[model samples]
Target: MNSKKMVLIGLVLTAFFSSLAVFELIPGLLMAFLLLSVGIAVTYYFALSRMRLESLAGISILLKAAKEIGKESKAPEISRQLGLWAQRLVKSEAVLVWWQGEWAFGDEEFTAWPGLETAREWVKNNNEVLVLNQNGGEIFSHPWPSNINSLLGLPLMVAGEAAGILFLLNESKRGYFVPQDSEALEVICQQAAAALNKARDYQEVEYFYKEILFSMLNALDSRFPGFTGHSQRVARVAVLLGSKLGLDEEELRILEYAALLHDAGKVFFLQEGLPGEAGELEEMDKELSVLPMEEHPPLGAQILPDEGVFARICQGILYHHERYDGSGYPEGLSRTDIPLAARIIAVADLYDALTRLAPEEERLEPEFAIKEMKKTMGMLLDPLVVIVLEEVERELDEIT
Candidate 1:
């Protein structure tokens, strides 16, 4: 109830009980005692109600923050964003995030605090939220920072398993971290724990997916020592060029898949007949059959599942060898008629093919690579793709 209504009800109860004692209708002692007792009870109830309202307000903030972190599906990004949310969670100036019992990111100075290790251990082992203050009895043997009067540590636990902890140091406008502050942090921690677990699962699946692709590509390249690593580099550079060209998330996903699987049609000729167990595939280093090199594009397209998501990916893989000027490939697709993903892979594939022939230290310099790349910009590769390649090369140069 609102304070005004509560007060009105309290007045009514007091007046009713006071009249009973004043008139001495039965026994004055019991009547007076009842009035006093009722007054105390009403005041206590009012205090509890106010606290409940404040707690509700805090819940609102917690939900908003949790929703923001929920949208991310990558563990590192989730942790980075968690640090930002931590400061707001408890109105702290600095926050340190720990994962797997080690510092992952956030304020480095929190690592300097003497009692932090002890505090963190307590939190992790107990899987609970801890609020510490210099003025309170929980004060540690080591001195605390003068400006900082309080500390809060919360473990990120899911299913009773703790993966990380959040430590907020030296609270600001919110005063000391209170029960409400720690409670807010706890809610966000749980949400983050779930997100972290999901992100990790996604990463594991992605790692295996890429590993399988590399295995197939390895089998295809087993015959040509100079051409080893060609397909992987093409996939890497294609994604980089695609990103530079402003392809959105889905486009990049398809582009990357197509690039990785572009040479997949040649996998069958690797003596094993098909890409087998990763271990078995690695051991069989037999030479590839002398198949028509130009046939692999159409063969790759046919091999990939053309249903749902892989449909566009297959098309891209199928026509990666097609040229911009209609002078190349199995279908002679020209210019934009070639799928964008294929066009991107085409540029990346040729660039890597030209440079990956030598050992790393002796490989063609990017400048020389680009000079060779420009020779077939129109006749052999997508013209626009080569332009983006130039920018990709420039970026690499500046980075190196």
Candidate 2:
């Protein structure tokens, strides 16, 4: 009962029992009423205090989750953190969060959790939170854990679009998630959605920037007559080689960008009308690829944006033409002095140049290209990179 109603009831009991005692009708009954009233009042006060404390705790946790979510900028990392927070917020045994991808937390052995997929679809279609509990629903018909009779599914909206779904499953003696639990989760989802949108925006901007860079690389390819798709092919091979060599994601990314832009420097020195068709380059212009050593590598490095994330990529490009035994271009840096990305790109670049369908004098048969690469392994290319290249070639051969 509400505090006002309880108070009125207590007062009425007080007067009723006191009247009996005043007439000496039943002093014992008056004593019993006094004890009962005091007990009820104390119990009511503690219950209210407990509810207030629980509410405050939920608010505090929500704020904490928001603060942590704001600190992450990567989509995957943000999803992970948010999933963890949701699990904690609802004290759920398992939480599933889905954005561009999905993450599951807690004990996920319950494969038969009914209505999960349906709930996801329902939230997506309706763009609203849905709660399922055993209070009066058929959703709990499926055999569930003794304590897990409720599911709270909230749609994570980003920029007016449903970006993801957050599910909280109850599997404890706490009975089931109540309406207040859903309310608290809704507040947390608001913050999570904002963070997710911010991270997604950052990702989209990065992707757009990379797209422009790729276009510029393609334009550079058009200038080299027979090398139209050389950059992209080299990048693909380089990524494959980098993976075989155990390069981490960051390293592979740098290698891919460098492979695409490795020849960007040659664009500055092309003679007029030199970039027409295959074999259109005059004999004199062909010599420019080898001569003027410092020009292309350093020039390509200078051509790339050196102030931000591309700086390392520029380094990779600058050294890609360097020889493994200190006999190559620009810096003549040998072995370990050459960046690993440059080493991997060098192998990929040379392999593509030899095997791709270029001029009659330039292109080599696939078998011949492999033989030629093996011949130059330790002298012109890093031995480790060449090994990865061979692995990639073997895999490709099997696929063929």
Candidate 3:
């Protein structure tokens, strides 16, 4: 028998012997002690079994919730899922706040509650989960409104750094939290922190990949004089158009990558004559010119897949030079058959090329470049994209 059962049996035997001494009934005391011991043992056995089952049920709930959270990538959805579970389990209001350099309550969905800003700052500064008993009858002073009696603030740590806090509130009952409650929250927080850190590490790895790709592009830019700033300019214009088009986060990423590395194949075209040498064309330049421009599209498509954002970007790089009519190279896709990202990059790239100072030609003025872009609409470029580019050019001109 467990310690609890043993203690109950000892108490019953003691009571029975004492009663026998007072009433002088020896046989009755023996029967009474035997029956009391049997009853106490049975009761304690059932109570212990029930306690073990309840503990298992609590653990199962946490495990199920953690599994569901692991599959989600969106922040708002994760918060909502956790909040719903908290509401069901604790009968309390739960809010999952996010940190974007600074903490903001989970996408403005729970902004009506007061004192969240202070609470967020506290979590950010301390990097430790806090359990506050808000009811005046309890230990800690209430930081929220009178209706909110208890608070549990869990820091969502990512990669050993705090990312945000998960806040749960109990409005009706105060001082109900025990040491066991805090321990459960700590377990949940640790699981959440691990998942969040994995996600953050994935994002950081992607950023590093993009940085490496851009560094390669920058090196290629250095190989050609008068083109030192060309890729950077194109990237700026592409990002501008991407924002104006209301591209989603994923699409914006693809567009940025394409713009930064569209001229990747130009690395293969670097001539030995150098940028401004004024010498005869080398055999390498002649060979490069004849090496099939059609291959550039496929070559870029091959190199970009390792960077997770490049599936869409490869299409942009391969088809950025394709004309709106069927007169373009490679696939010869025309009109809307061309991807929108490719179409946007085409306009931005051509505009930058036209305005840049070449070795033999004067730099085209912004007005002239806009006019020329308009002239080529529906033939060399997508007409609608040209309209957007014109607007972008005007805005850029005003800023300058």
Candidate 4:
């Protein structure tokens, strides 16, 4: 029968016997029997009530603990929360122990606890929870402190593999943990395992994304001559200039992207039209050279997606060759009418080209290249951009 019903039946029987003794002539013996029975029933009732209350309290503690654990996204936070909850539930100290390829607790650096290595080895060997008695006196039982007689350990399992163990200790020698206590702890461990796995998966996905982006950049480099290291260099220079110009993070990112892919449209341009071939151009070749040069900027714009940062980069690509005096092709936008990214790239592209070798001749001496750049400052280039280039040139010389 249910405990409540059994308690009620005992109380009723006690009352009936008491009434019988009181009404009968044979008084003393029956009266003593009735008093003993009534005392036993009352004591049993109180004990059962306390047990029920403790069970309910245990359930409430676990529910709150599980809810808090569910809300946490970090492993250290989870461990701290588990420690706090165990302290509150059992009125004692607790520790959360985890093992991967190595053992650890929270985000703290790993240190070997005296018995932990042994515990971990045992779990790995047997794949089960280990509970020990007090006094370190038990063989075939997990170890517990003499001061804290009760100890409970629950295995954290994922896919039937032991991931870690949860150890709860009572400072006062409460009786050994009941089956219900172990059951509640097991549920908490299950939730923790799931959370850890999710974090691991997220980290893996992030690494994969970075790998993919770098590989794509490498592929683009392989297809274009003299373009292998160009994008990274441009990005670095653009970011430097963007910082000097007091651009915000978002603006800096756009400038960097534009610089990296400024010649992306050239991917579609004829290979023979590269700057290296400029010296080899025959009189008849001028027509072909001019055609590809005129088409690249617009074609680059068409190659990328039509919105956001990519679109902005495309706009920059389309106009990087445009001149300040309306002499440039595709569109003759002059001076401030051109986008800032295109203006910045115009200076960078020219500097790189002038300082590098081409098919016809060796790269120009720095002094001669600077003089040529100064000549075109207000007509072919933005006057401010020319000033910035002069400063950058000085810095490069100092570093060299």
All candidates: TM-score: 0.47, 0.50, 0.50, 0.43
lDDT of each: 0.72, 0.70, 0.65, 0.62
Tell how far residue 96 is off in model 2, in angstroms: 12
Residue 195 of model 4 has an lDDT of 56
Candidate 2 vs 3: which has more lDDT? 2
What lDDT does model 3 reach? 0.65
Q: Which digits, one per residue and each the tens of the lDDT, describe model 1 over residues 271-311?
A: 54543432222221111111236777887788655665567
- Model 1 CA deviation exceeding 4 Å by range: 1-60, 135-139, 171-175, 202-212, 221-271, 274-400
For candidate 3, list the clashing residue pairs, or say none: none
**Per-residue lDDT for 333-361 in model 2, tens only?**
99989988888888877777666634567
**Greater-TM-score candidate between 3 and 4:** 3
Error (Å) of candidate 4 at residue 259 is 26
- Look at candidate 1 and give me any clashing residue pairs: none
| lDDT of candidate 3 at residue 228, scale 0 to 100 | 67
Compose the digit string of candidate 4's lDDT tens values, residues 1-400: 5667776877787777777777785487867876787778778877888899998988887888888776665556666666666556655444555645543353222123345455556666677766655544533354434455655666667668876666665556456665566665766677776655544544443453365435545655665444456556656655665666677655666676667666666555444445434223222121111123567678766766665345766777788877887777678998889888887777666655565423336456656766777788778788777676666665544322
